[model samples]
Target: MNSAEFRAVFRYIQALLIITQASLVLTDHREMLPPSPADINWLMHEWTPTVVRETNYSHRAIIPARNSQTRAAIAKVTTCDASAALTAQFFTEVEPAVRWLRSIYVV
Candidate 1:
């Protein structure tokens, strides 16, 4: 997707994040190109912080590693997660990923 398309999607995700106490960002950039530095920076500076601050509980991502390109994008998001508390991790499947995210809430 192009920058504008990326921004629009991110905005929608960010808005959903803002209204929820805890949430998941399901980013499967399957056929799409890996995000640009501008996209990564937008997540770092804008999207992540906004979501982290908005959500009262944990926020996580389930970005399946469909390819090396997707893995790289997950890595960037994972790094950003360290500071934002929006934990982004890659998985090959959905079930285990969602299970892990739910496990985070258990006391």
Candidate 2:
């Protein structure tokens, strides 16, 4: 996705968080594409921290992680980057990811 689209997604997520009053679980089933430098910069410098600051929990499951070491590393880095703002984790399977998210909601 382009930078603008990425920004829009953050906005959408923010809105969803407000409306649902719930934690987020983002699962991507598609093959990974390296984000543009601009997109990465925006995510690191702006979106990741700002949007997540008020968030209590947000998890991202990379369904393709089992096949990609690069993706697994990316997931780890993303969690670290947002660690101060919220709880974030990555999983290779959706079921476990959902279970983790559910557990957080109950806590």
Give per-model TM-scores: 0.72, 0.67
Best by TM-score: 1
Model 2 error, position 59 (Å)? 4.9
Candidate 1's C-alpha lDDT? Answer: 0.66
Model 1, 11-59: lDDT tens digits are 8776666666346555555556677888888877777777667665354
Clashes of each: 0, 0
Give candidate 1's TM-score. 0.72
For candidate 1, list the clashing residue pairs, or say none.
none
Give the per-residue lDDT digits (tens) of candidate 2, residues 1-107. Answer: 66677668767877777677666656563465555566656666666676667654455544553335436545544755664555556566778877876766664
RMSD of each: 2.9, 3.3
